[model samples]
Target chain A: MIELKNIKKSFDGLEVLKGISMTFEPGKTNLIIGQSGSGKTVLLKCMLGLYSVDSGSMLFGNRPLENMDDNQRRILRREIGMVFQGSALFDSMTVLENVMFPMQMLTDQDEKSIRAAAHEVIDRVNLNEATQKLPAELSGGMQKRVAIARAVVMRPKYLFCDEPNSGLDPKTAIVIDNLIREITKEYNITTVINSHDMNSVMEIGDTILFLKDGLKAWEGNKKQIFKTDNEAINNFVYSSRLMKKVKEVYQ
Target chain B: MKLLHHIGAYLLMLRLVFIKPTKAKVMRKLIFKDIQDLIVGSLGIVAFLSFFVGGVVAIQTALNIESPLIPKSLVGFATRQSVILEFAPTFMCIILAGKVGSFITSSIGTMRVTEQIDALEVMGINSVNYLVFPKLVAMMLLPLVINISMFLGILGGYTATLYGGFSSSADFIDGIQMDFKPFHVFYAFIKTVVFAIVLATIPAYQGYYMKGGALEVGKAATVAFVWTSIVIIVLNYMITQLLLA
Candidate 1:
């Protein structure tokens, strides 16, 4: 499990994460949702250790991430898997090579075992036919799958996805969402996703942290989120056409 | 102040580049790839420029010695002097700053633009060592290319002087042997090694620290070339003063 206690982050004296606190349990998809400039990405980056928080503590399973030495941080980083908003696969490497990169860099596994491990995840992501294809040759959805395979090939304790469904079509987006949820449950990984896609929030958002203007405005699951009357989250939820129709039916 | 900041940052980057070294297994692969990209890929152009420019120097030197008071062998000696002392080491590197410098800058800058560097970092890899050190190691072999340039340059000088009727083969060969200080060749090579470092690092610094998107990558390449050439020319002057003057 990952826990944040009063997490605050600022850039150039402008505070982005305003002492936000939340618990992300293992074996579930924890979605952080907010509109543009609402600090969801900032919060995610801080948890990822990409940004240093001003005066708050982030506990990754009782180990405070803010105070770790370089060696400790590196060890922790290896246990954390990130799927970037752009999918960020090395364009030069083929699908198999990209999947096998982390293991080759960090593990003592032999080549035969590493190849088998990479193929296992490649199969998990259903990218078996594109093993030799570079990232440029893959479609957007396929690229995301490659990124996912690379991220989870090591069987990380934590998984972070930044807008995993941004450019994918609706059907492909749902597939990616379900894939992440299934992987999270199977591995018992603490999965934190930063997204604005309502479909993702409703489909696989086992837990949701709603941030508004740098503050945690509400906390709940997809089932409970619609029933809440928090004005900020209501604005967010009803801003969607589908949610607007749902609100009309409720009225 | 901004210049001082860049210099400080550049030095810091150099410091970071050698620390927490990437695994030797990975580094060996990276080094070979860089060699393929940086050294083997560059042989043809370096050879072409050296040959043609060496011929030009000989023809120009021959034309200028029009008076009967001068021996025909002086044509060969002057060609040797120009090619060895300046054209092959300094001028050729300046040209390479355009070819190779831009290449290093654009490729790294594109990686930055695409967030590949961040991917390396998130994997607990030292992105600097992973990216720049391989290029640095590959450029250590740069002197080999410079040696070839020097040889092909003199060969071009020999061909031009002999075939252009400016000097006899014997006179030209004799002139090449005239007062040949091994130090001059040593000096040229010393300059090549130093210039090689400048060629590899300055462009890399520009690319690694560059911000903005695809357009900024092209701009950074231009900026890296300009700064690399300027440093190379300045270093050439300083080295010449110390060694030859």
Candidate 2:
């Protein structure tokens, strides 16, 4: 489990995260959802130790992240895997090489063993056929799968996905979301996804934190999300044309 | 205050690059790749410049001298001095600053903007150690090799001049032996080393700090080339005055 307490951050005097705090439980998908410029990504980055918090602290199983030195933070970082929004695969590397990179860097394993481990994860992500392809050669959805494969290839204890379904087709987005959710459940990793996709919320948001203008506006699962009367979240949820139609149907 | 912060970051990056150089094997590969790209790839330019510059110096010196006051072959000595002391080291560095320096800046800057650097950081890898060290070492070592190649290229030009009847081979040898100073070569060698460091560090620093997107990487590369060229020219003048004076 991950716990954040009074987390605050600002860039050039513009406060982005304003004393926001939330918990991300293990064995479930904990989502931080907000619109563009709403501090969801900043909060995620803070949790990952990419940004130093101005005040308060983040605890990974009650271990404060802010006080650790570079080496200690690196070691902690090794236990976490991140899938960036754009599927930040190393373009110079083939898909197989990209997936095998973490193992090659962090482990003293032999080449044969590393290759085998990489292939195993590729297979798990249903990307076995495109192992030799470069990221540029793959479709948008395929690239995301490769990114996912690389992330889980290390079998990290904590997984972070930033807009995993962004720029993907609705069908492919659901597939990616389900894949992430299934992987989280199977590994029982503490998984946090930053997304604006309502489909993802309904499908795999076992725990959700909703943000509006850098503040924690609400917190609940998907089932409770639809039932909540919070005007801020209501405006965000019903702003989507499809959600509005769904609301009308329910009414 | 920002300058101090930048200096602190530079020191941090330098420490990371040197203290644990072999922590990242990929860095070793990158260094070797850069050596091939910079030294091996610049062979044609070195050969062309050395021959043409040597020929031009020989021809110009031959035209000005009257009779036997200076041996017609003393032109070769002047040519050698020009190539070794000024042309080979300085011009070669300028060429490399344009070529390898820009390449490093753009590639690494693109990686930075794209979050590949962050990926390395998140993977418990020192991005500087993995990315900058190899390129720095490669740039430092490869320029000396290119200087040697440039020297041999000047010799090729001497051969061309002698064969074309611009001067006698014996006279050429005699001329070079008369004007050659051990200190001149030493100065060139030291200057090349300094040039290599400046060329590599400036670009790598610019590249490492790049933010934004693909366009920004291009902007960083352009900035690196411009700044490196300016620095090289300014330092060349300063060092030349200091050493030659």
Candidate 3:
């Protein structure tokens, strides 16, 4: 499990995450949903340790992330997996190489075992046919799959996905979302995903945290989300007429 | 003040680059790749420029020595002097600042633009050590290329002087051997090594710190080249002053 206590972050004196306190349980998809410029990405980055929190504490399991020394932090980072919004696969490497990169960097595993491990993840993502191909050769959805394979190949304790469905079509987006949820359950990993896709929030958002203008607007599961009457989240969730109609039927 | 800040940052980057790599195997692969890209890839152009410029120097020197009192051997001597003292080292590096410098910047800048650098960082890799250290290793082999340039340059000078009938082969050979101070070759090589460091690191600094997309990458390459050339020229003066003054 991962926990954040009074997490606050700012850039150039402009506060972005305002005292967010939350618990992300293991074996579930924890989705942080917010509109653009609503601090979702900033909060995700802080939790990823890409940005130092001005005032806060992040606990990965029982260990406080902010208190770990450099070597300790690095060791912990190895146990963490990140799927960037852009998919950030090394364009220079083949699919297999990209998947195997973290293991090669962080472990002394022999090449034979590493290759086998990489193939296992690639097959998991249904990307076995594209093992030798570079990222440029893959479609957007395929690239996201490759990114997912690379991230989880290490069997990390924590998984972070930043807008995994951004450029994907609706059907492909659902495939990626379900894939993440399935992996989270299978590994019992503490997964945190930052997304604005309402479909993702409704489909696989086991737990959702809604943010508005740097503050938590609402917190609940997808089933609970449709019943909530919080103004900010209601406005955000039902901003579209179709979603409003869906809410009307549910209500 | 901005200049001072850049210098300090550049020095700090160097310090970071010397840190122990997380994986020696990965570092070994990167070093070999950089060798192929930065050194081996540059051989053909450096050779071409070295030879043609050497021929041009011989011809120019021969034409200007109209006074019969000045022996024709001066053509060979001047060619050797010009090639070794300035053209092969300084001019060739300036050319590389365009070819190799721009390459380092654009590639790294694109990685930055694409978040590949961030990927490395998130993986707990020291991105500087992973990226710049390989280039530094590859460029340390630069003196090998410069030695080849020096040889081809003299051969070009010999060809131009003998064919143009400006000097006999024997006289030209004798002139080249006239005041051959090994120190001058040593001095040129010292300058070459120093310039190689500038070539590898300045462009890297530009690329690593750059912010923006493809268009900004292009701009950073231009800026890296300009600063690298400036540093190379200034270092050339300083080295020459300290050692050869």
The lDDT leader among the candidates is 3
Worst 10 residues of 3 chain A by lDDT: A41-50
Better of 2 and 3 by TM-score: 3
Q: Evaluated on chain B only, what is the TM-score of candidate 1?
A: 0.98
Residue-by-residue lDDT tens digits, candidate 3, A109-227: 99999999999989999998999999999999999999999999999999999999999999999999999999999999999999999999999999999999899889999999888
lDDT of 1 by residue, B76-131 (tens): 78878888889888988898899889999999999999888888888999999998
* CAPRI class assigned to model 2: medium
Would you list the clashing residue pairs of candidate 2?
none
Supply DockQ values for each candidate. Answer: 0.77, 0.56, 0.76
Better of 2 and 3 by DockQ: 3
- Mark the regions of model 3 whose C-alpha exceeds 4 Å error after superposition: none
- Prediction 3 global C-alpha lDDT: 0.92
Pairs that clash in candidate 1: none
Ranking by DockQ: 1, 3, 2
Interface RMSD after interface superposition, model 3 = 1.0
Each model's fnat?
Answer: 0.58, 0.48, 0.68
Output the lDDT of residue B147, model 1.
Answer: 85
Model 2 residue A85 CA deviation in Å: 1.3
Per-residue lDDT of model 1, residues A1-251, tens digit only? 99999988888989888899999999999999999999988888888888889988999999999889999999999999999989999978999999999999999899999999999999999999999999999999999999999999999999999999999999999999999999999999999999999999999999999999999999999998878889999999899688899878977
Candidate 3: which docking quality band?
A: medium
lDDT tens readout by residue for model 3, B113-200 = 9888888888888999999999999999988888889888988999988888888998899889888999999999999999999999
